[model samples]
Target: MSARAGSFSFDRKDLSRFLFDLYDYEPKLLRKLISARPYVCPFEDIERHIPEDAKVLDVGCGNGALLAILLASGRVKVAVGCDVHEGALASARMAAERTGNAGHVSFLKIRGFEELPADSFDVVTMVDVLHHVPEGDRVKAVEEAIKRVAAGGIFLFKDMVEAPFWRRLAHNVDDLIFSGEWVRQVKTAKVEAQVKAAGFELFESLEIPRIFYGNTLRVFRRL
Candidate 1:
């Protein structure tokens, strides 16, 4: 993403500055990350997949960007956003209120994937938060997110990827130079395998380039 007017490009130092300057800005970091990305490409195809008033679950729903979008469209009657970061959840709640969607979205502070019930939601989505999760736990997180989804619903994910060599090198350099943010990890293929292992099938894979980095929009449906 192009550097915001006053906001420095997000790097490790900038992320550190952000965490401190907005210690309670867990969700804000999330919002900025998504803002940097192109418009929700996943929404184009999956929008038609969601049923009216479906029990949509936004897992790793940092600051409710997607949740707000879905709710605003009047497609989702009930939406729940859960994050392991309490600070992020708090900010997510505030965003909902600010967006006039507090009535439709519920933000929950969870400690891990274990905290959420199995098969509890109609649709579950993990946005840009997957790579942030520690590597060892990523699989289980996907598992839990899928378990929360009802059969016939979708599990949507649109985030960074491990692309071609130069493209990936660019991603690393950008992370190092502009944002000092290492992306922590990149799991494009692993996530594909994990999603399938969790009883869902991948239906779409699209390449989308954004301001600062690029992404892969992967959409899956529960079997």
Candidate 2:
């Protein structure tokens, strides 16, 4: 699959090749994990918001694909990935080491948002994660994610939003079958309100079109 955002071309095949080059010598298990979960969005889309020499924290970092990309781009000074899955964390560590980013990036096994330190990272990212959070804890999760962002830092939130009837049905069915759980449709207005209540100023809210469904990427700055 290929996606173009401005001058950037996001080709899944090319990203797969890059991952292979980085993980070829690694263990078979790690290689398989990286191959299974390719980049979800174009690198340029995410890279543009990250400043040079910034400390980054990626919540729900599955297999560390995004973290590795950020570190490899040479724009990040320190990258930390926190996830609940042990297998994913292991793969993330291996990917970082293989890509020569182990020194700059590290993965932590965390149970929830409460474990993260407050105001520590310059860039905080939660990509495709909010929906996975339980309904009762979603708001708390977002608040914690916001708290991790330092003053004047950016919080990048990307996830699937409510779509049309047919599109939403397909999206939910796909999620149920593959993820073994119902996909919660995220309401953009509700999320924005939560961010605003937390003292974050919404700087950008973009809807990027995709083949099957659309994604919303919002950038917020903590005041």
Clashes of each: 10, 0
Candidate 1 residue pairs in clash (backbone atoms < 3 Å)? 1-211, 1-212, 10-179, 11-179, 11-180, 11-181, 12-179, 12-180, 12-181, 119-147
- After TM-score superposition, the amount by which residue 161's alpha carbon in candidate 1 deviates from its true location, in angstroms, is 1.5
How close to the true structure is residue 76 of candidate 1, measured as C-alpha lDDT? 75
The residue pairs found clashing in candidate 2 are none
Which candidate achieves the best TM-score against the true structure? 2
Model 2: residue 43 alpha-carbon error in angstroms: 3.1
Candidate 1 local Cα displacement, residue 152, angstroms: 1.0
RMSD of each: 7.9, 4.5
Candidate 2, 38-155: lDDT as tens digits: 4435455777899989999999998787887666656688888999999878878877876565799878888888987554899999998888888889888988888888889999
| Model 2 TM | 0.85
Q: Where does the lowest 10-residue lDDT sum fall in candidate 1? A: 1-10
Q: What's the true lDDT of residue 97 in model 2? A: 73
Which ranges in model 1 have alpha carbons more than 4 Å from their true place? 1-49, 166-181
